[model samples]
Target: MTTILVTGGTGTLGRLVTERLRADGHEVRVLSRHTQPYAVDLREGGPGLDAALDGVETVVHCASSPRGDEQAADHLIAAARRAGVGHLVYISIVGVDRVPFGYYRSKLAVERRIEESGLRWTVLRATQFHDLVVTMLQKLAKPPVVLVPAGVSDQPVEVAEVADRLAELALAAPAGRVPDMGGPHVRTFDSLARAYLRATGRRRRVLGMPLFGKTYRAFRAGGHLAPEQAVGKGTFEEYLARRFGQ
Candidate 1:
């Protein structure tokens, strides 16, 4: 049995990974901001991490900043190496290389750092999750007309799917930049917004607003899709039905 350390274990993806790993008979430890025995924050380079990583053979790094956290990734990689950990698995967004946005750029930098470290690592790139869809719905709720960025296509995935894949990676040998993981079907931001409105019985016009910059261009170019990679199971309709139970 391997000892697994999962960062951001309290979040949606992290919690699922921890539970799955625990159910698989592995000793699982979580890290958070609070000063628990195994929990610590990554912003300050995570103090007391030496004790947290005691006997840990594998690390599933699910922690991240919305604006991206390169330093946090750097620190974790360095710490795991110093602790003589066997493997490090990182969860990344799908469009890092294509987008080159600040956050995506940070992710790429972290990925490069891991590759250059000569340590065993696996980087799993996943499309946006259902949670992102939920967030969009919440935004639409505020405005009578839902203004969305134009020309962006996505195959939004389930966070659980991402977690399961991370767990699978934890068990497999480290392979850099594995096949991408995405949702069941492709749709635009407009369609997603419309689906949410329809599901919630909210009447709103989804206005496709023009976008600018590399971020917008990247998304428009299908940077958010997994063209030939792993496809997710849950459909947006299925997700809404399960979430709303109707």
Candidate 2:
């Protein structure tokens, strides 16, 4: 069995990936900021990272934040190199290169760093998660009227499916930049907000606002969509029913 280390092993996607790897009878190492024995903060380069990478053959990098991801990736690459890890797998958003947002730019930078790190690597770009879409709708519904960006759409994929794909990739040889994974449907933001309101039994008037900006324009133009690669099986309504018991 291969010894694989999963960063952010306690997170939404990482936790599921860890479980899958363990179920397959592989030695799984969970790395997080607070987890003992492997508690190393990737944002800061430290000795704990080296210990975590010890004797690890593959690493599934799932730890990420709104900021400091680039720095974290640099630390991970250096530590993996020192440990002689063979394969490095990364999960990224679909539109990191096309979208001009700060977070997307940071994700793109991490992808580039991994590509040129002189290590075998694979990167998978996926659409937004259903949980993130729900969180966004929750914030929008806080006000009496929910205001969503006009002409913007999203394809929300299930996190479990993403985790499953990562596990499969970890077990196989490194293949750089595999096919993109997208949700089954390309839905508008307002429609998704309405779905959330219905599922939660909330009454809020949803309004679409025409915002003018490069980021918004890119979103409207569907830079983040992967219609040709709609490989995910879950739907937003199904996810809502499972989450809210509707």
Candidate 3:
């Protein structure tokens, strides 16, 4: 069995990836900021990190922080190389390079670092998670109306699906820049808001607001979608039903 290390093991996608790897009979080490079982903050660069990477054959890096993404990636890659880790699997977002958002830009920068780390690596860029999209709509839903950006589309894949794919990649030989994974269907922000309203038995009007600047324009141009690489089978409706039992 291989000894694998998973960063951001407490987050949505990272948690599922950790579970999948452990269920497959591999010895998994989880890294976090707190003083938990395998606590090792990427920013701190503590000695616990060396212990965590010791005997680790592969690293499924899912840790992400928009403010310090580049530094964190650099540290992790350097540590892994020093520890002689076999492969490094990185989970990225689709259209990170194309999107003008700061977080996306940070992710793109991390991807480039991983590619040039001089180690075996695989990068999988996936669409947004279903829960994230739902959370966005829920947060925007107000008393009378849910405000959404006009002309923007969402192709949200399930977090578990992305986790499963990451697990498979961690076990196989490193493949640079693999195919993108997206949801089964792409829907407009308006339609997604309406569907969320119907599922939750709310009748809030969805107002499509015209947003300006490069971020909105990139979203409207479907920068976050991969129409030709829609590999995930989960749909937004099914995710809503599972989440809300509607």
Candidate 4:
């Protein structure tokens, strides 16, 4: 059995990845900042990480922060190198390079670091999760009229599917930047909001607002979509049903 370490073990994706790895009979270690079996701050590069990396064969990096993603990768990569970890699997968002958002830019920077770390590594870029989409729609619904960006599309995947793929990658030899994983369906933002309202039995006016800037332009240009790589089995409707009991 391989000894694996899962960063961001407490987050949505990280927790699922950790469970999958454990179920597959690999020795799994969880690394989180708040509280855990191993409490390690990715931004600090402290002794906690050094201890966690000891004898670890593989590392599935799922911990990422909008502000300190690069810093966390720097520390994790350094510790992994020192510990002679066999493979490093990094979870990334699709269109990080294509999208002009600051968060995506930071993710791309971390991807570059992992590529240059001289370790056997694989980067898996996936579309946004269904949970995120639902959360955003819920927050926007609080307003009198839910306003969505015009010409933007969303392809959200199930978190469990991404977690299963990460476990598969963790067991195999590192393949650099594997094929992207996206949802089964690609729909416009306005349609998604409408579906969400219908699922929750809410009647809110949905408005498509013309958003300006390069970020919206990139998103409208399908920067966040991967129709050719849409391999996830679960649809957004199924996710809504399962999550909300619709």
Candidate 5:
């Protein structure tokens, strides 16, 4: 069995990835900032990183914050190189290259670093997660009137499906930049917010706001969409039903 180390193993996607790998009978090590024995802060290059990488043949990097991802990736890459890890797998957003947002830019930079790190690597870009979309809707619904960006849409995918795909990729050979994974439908932000409101039994007037900015324009233009790669089967309504019950 291959020994694999999963960074951010306690996170939403990473936790599922760890479970999948362990179920497949691989020796899996979970590394997080607070997890015991493998606790290592990737951002600051904490002390226990080297120990976690010991005998690890593959690494699934799922640990990411809003900021400091590049520094974390650099530290992880250097540690992986030192430990002679063979394969480095990264999970990224679908429009990191096309979207000009700061977080997207950081994700793109990490992708590039992994590509040129002189190590076998694979990168998978996926659409936004259902949880993130829900969070956005929650914030928008806080006000009496929900104000969503006009003309912007989101293709929300299941996090479990993403984790399953990552596990499969980790077991296979490094195939740099695999096919993008997208949700079943591309719905407008307004529709998704309405879905959330319905699921939670909240009544709110949803309005579209025409925000001016390159980011908003890019989102409106669907730079973040992967219409050709709508591989996910879960729908927002289904997710809501499962999460909040019928």
Candidate 6:
């Protein structure tokens, strides 16, 4: 059995991927600042990573901040390379190339690093997740004012699906930049907020406003939705149903 080291094993997406890998019978190890069975911090590189990566056939880089832009990924990439890790699988967001978001630019930088590293690698680009949806709901909980981008859209997918896809990548040849994974339905902020309200039985009103900034403009241009590459089975309705138990 191959040993797989996961970087962000405690996170929503990372946890699922690590669990899947462990379930697949691979010897899975977690890499965090906290020492455990096996751990390595990306911020500080060295023999620590080498020790954790011993006999590791694959490295699933799920460890990252919400704003995992290039500058952050650089250290991660350097650490992985120094460890001589075999297969490097990166989970990235969709529309990084199309959107002018700093986070996306950082993600793109890492992708370029792996491409030029000569190491076998796979980059799985996916859309937003239910976590983002939940967070948005909380952020816009104020009554009579759920401010949102007037015309921006989203196709949030299940984080579990993204995990499964990452596992599939680990088992298969590095597909380079793989197909985009999106939710079952295309929706606007208004629709998502309404669904969330109905799901939680909240009576908050939504205030649709114009999307500003380069990021907002990029999002409004449909740069985030990947109709051509979209492949998912979970819809927002089902997500709400499962979340609300209705």
For the record, the alpha-carbon RMSD of candidate 2 to the native fold, in angstroms, is 0.6
Model 4 per-residue lDDT tens digits across residues 1-246: 999999998899999999998898889999999866689889998988989999999999999886898999999999999999989999999999999999999999999999999999999999999999999999989987999998899999999999999999999999999999999989999999999998999999999999899999999999989999999999999999998899
In candidate 2, residue 233 scores what lDDT?
A: 99
Deviation (Å) of 61 in candidate 2: 0.3
Rate residue 212 of model 2 by lDDT. Answer: 89
Worst 10 residues of 5 by lDDT: 45-54
lDDT of 6 by residue, 1-246 (tens): 878888888888888998998899998888876757656557555567667777777888887764534544566566667767778999888898999988788777778987887788999889999778878877887656788779978998988889998988998877788878888778898889888888888888787888569898899998988877668888877888997886
Query: Which residue pairs of candidate 5 clash?
Result: none
For model 1, how does the per-residue alpha-carbon lDDT over 171-198 read when each residue is reduced to its tens digit?
8898988988988888888898888887
State the displacement of the C-alpha of residue 71, model 2, in Å, after optimal TM-score superposition.
0.7
Best by lDDT: 2
Model 6, CA-based lDDT: 0.81
The clash count of every prediction, one per candidate, is 0, 0, 0, 0, 0, 2
Which has the better lDDT: candidate 2, or candidate 4? 2
All candidates: TM-score: 0.95, 0.99, 0.97, 0.98, 0.99, 0.92
lDDT of the candidates, in the order given: 0.84, 0.97, 0.91, 0.94, 0.95, 0.81
True-vs-predicted CA distance for residue 74, candidate 2, Å: 0.7
Query: What is the clash count of model 5?
Result: 0
lDDT score for residue 48 of model 1: 75
Reference-based TM-score, model 2 = 0.99
Better of 4 and 6 by lDDT: 4
lDDT of 4 at 183: 96
